[model samples]
Target: MRISTSQFYETSSANYQRNFSNVVKTGQQASDNIRVRTAADDPVGAARLLQLQQQSNLIDQYDGNITNVRNSLGTSESTLNGITNILARVKELTISAGSGGYTDADRKADAQELTQLEEQLYSLMNSRDENGKYLFSGSRGDTPPYVRNADGTYTYQGDQSTLSLQVGDMLTMASNESGYSVFEQALNTSRSQTKLTSPLVDDGRVSLSNGQVSGSTQYNDRFRGGEPYTITFTSSTQFKITDAANNDVTLEATGEGKFDPSKPGGVTFRGVEMALDINLSDADKPNADALIAGHTFSLGSKPDEVSGSRSPGNTSSSQITGASISDSTAYNNAFPGGGAVIKFTSASAYEVYAQPMGPDARPVATGTLTGTPATKAKIAGVDFDFSAPPAAGDQFSVKVDNHQTQNILDTISEFRKALELPVDKDLASRQKYQGALQSAIGNLESGANKVAEAISSIGARGAALDVQADTNESLKMANTKTQSSIRDADPAEVLTRLSLQQTMLQASQLAFTKISSLSLFNRL
Candidate 1:
């Protein structure tokens, strides 16, 4: 084969250049320790490395989220501990104030101290996290959870929504508790709003007093949901108790619903006790005792809905709005038998009847239109405003609701008011004070129990966060190992390949020089 001198030099030069390029590439791989520098190095391995890298980043982000959740839960738990301590102190002060020897001035001093503790509780309940967000404000981290009202009571401003953070690939954690759950929705077991049914004809001879929940567990089981429980006197010496569905509940306690008013004790049923005083000596045997026999007393019913509607026969532009229960006891008394109707005697004068609107029934309450459109009106204990005045004979009817919960702050505020009041030695004053004190103590205990429950929940969340953090650490370690294996170069293999390529390049250079010099001119 005949070859030109230029062709021979070109082939030799190409061989040396190829060997040198291999040495430089292998050296780069050895220095960097990366096997796949680009897609061309190893297409499938490079794609796998990208996926592993994304997973590693995700794990890092989850670790950060776990830290944030732990901080939030820790702050919340610390704040709740402070609240628990304050509530304990308040309970101690309250119990001490109940001593009969403690004068009004002494009680007032206790109230002043309680006020300070309550303020502290308020501050703690509105705690903030390291990020300057309110801890108990639920989803409304920027807003205060509790606000003091003009009446010196605290109102919950936050909602029931929880703020949750993603802590793992498939797990999310609630970073905060709603104030409503932690403090506002505590149960008031001592609530016993008692009233006589409207059907009882009275000459002010019968009085019910000391109405309270004597057994918390039984009372809660029976009356917590505002279920209507009624006591009806089958006779002057006996009464039958029935539930909302009118099923005889007294039968469960005693086979026969029997009571002797002549006995020293009052009527007791299902953890509730109330003193029923009847002037038996003054009783008009056939008439007064007969009224007592048919009389019904409803206990512990709550206001669920307060609304009004205009009568279809009404010829006026009158409409009622903002109807609500101002006093639950009065509302229950007003509608023990049924609903109430507002009948206009004139453009400005109105009468309220406890029964449905009818000509024969007498009015139970009366009110005068004060505004041009008669803006303000109240019936029994329900308050409502009117948009316009009704013409003569126009009527409106109000309905009752049976659902409500007293918040923790309201319970504390009520106790504060009772402590601040000065009670005389009179029987009525002393009895009233005793009742208020008893109710306040029961409610405070309920609030304390609720706070404890919240603390326990926070602790559980903290434990869960700890577990997630450890899991994330394990996952991070595993992911790092996987990434290194898929994308990193073996140091020994790269260095050996680089050495071999360098030696080959040197041999190619020496051979090319020898051959190039020995062309036809040099050989001749």
Candidate 2:
């Protein structure tokens, strides 16, 4: 297989050019320290790098969000701490004022102090976070949490929806709590009574009769009279009356006026014309006859009597036209006075009276009454009237939400009340309010703690990301080394190859020159 001169020259030139081109390409790649500078260089690795870079950027964004949430939580914690302090001061003032030794002026001073404290607490509850969001407001963080009215009541402005933060891919934690749960629902300070009054009265009496008498005649014929009478009571009070037989007769008041002689009225005496009268009075009064005279009495049946005799039963029933006397006799000894004694039926309904006591006067203090028909007496301000019935347990509760603005005002108002109340009776109330405040504090703390936990989780994730980033950087370096080994050229190796190629190209040119010179044309 003898190679032709033309063929050898052509093949050697091609081989030399190819080797030179390879050396240039490898040298450029080594200088750049990259195997795949573009997608055309290595499509798979370039795409993977792009995806990793995007993940890293997302991690950075998450870190920024976690930082913001952490700052908000910190602000909330600080504000709640301030509120806790104010509540503590209020408790102290309540204890001081409740001692009963404080004069009215002293109490007033205490009240003023409490008012200031309350205002401060309100401000704290309505405080804002670093992001200009209300700390106690649930989801409505931009609005104020409490509002105060001219009537001295507070309204809530926050909503019940909770605020939350995403700390991880699938983890979320609460960032805020509602004002209603912290304030209104947690603070309950009312009580009720147990016993109730019966709806019945006891003392009711009536009598009735009819007859005719001759005024200036020698004689008159006998006649008979028929009468019907009834006395209805206001309530079901129990009472007893003595009949002519000296037997005891018992009676009770019906809610309605239903007179049944077989049930309550006494039997009639025999063989005499008698005057009839009825009396209704309290069973405790000393004078009963003065209460009884000329009052009409209801009778069950008719009676026979002699005419022209002095029959004393015919009279009007509307008015008691007899002389009024404060006599204790002639009526049953149980009558006291012509008055009604009303009683309350339940204790819870009776708390309306007790509530006034907290605001009006201290248990043993001397203060002027503010209501009508006022009588001045050395009376305990805690006295209550049970003349009306109340419902069972006397429990009532109210809840308010969306109170971002009003929460502060309400807290201040309650704190002021706790401070101004009489020290003697307000100890329990103050303690109760303190408990409510503590619960609010706890809610704040819990929210803050959750934020803190999220922050911790974020920090952990950031640290892990940092480690991943470091590992990625190292892997990138290793990949560069592998690429260099696979496709890049070292300067020494490229120089050697270039020299060998130059030598071969020079040899090829010499051979081509000799071959052309030795051709047939040169022989001729």
Of the candidates shown, which would achieve the greatest TM-score relative to the real structure? 1
Candidate with maximal lDDT: 1
lDDT of the candidates, in the order given: 0.74, 0.42
**lDDT for each residue of candidate 2 in 75-191, tens digit (9 for 90 to 100):** 665666666666666656656654646654676687798678767876877888766888766777777877664336655556566776554455454555556455434321111
After the best TM-score superposition of candidate 2, give how far the Cα of residue 125 lies from its true spot, in angstroms.
Answer: 1.5
lDDT of 2: 0.42
lDDT of 1 by residue, 101-122 (tens): 8998998899898888878887
Error in Å for residue 93 of model 2? 1.7
The weakest ten consecutive residues by lDDT in model 2 span 188-197
Residue 221, model 1: Cα distance from true site in angstroms: 6.9
Deviation (Å) of 505 in candidate 1: 1.4
Error of 2 at 84 (Å): 1.5
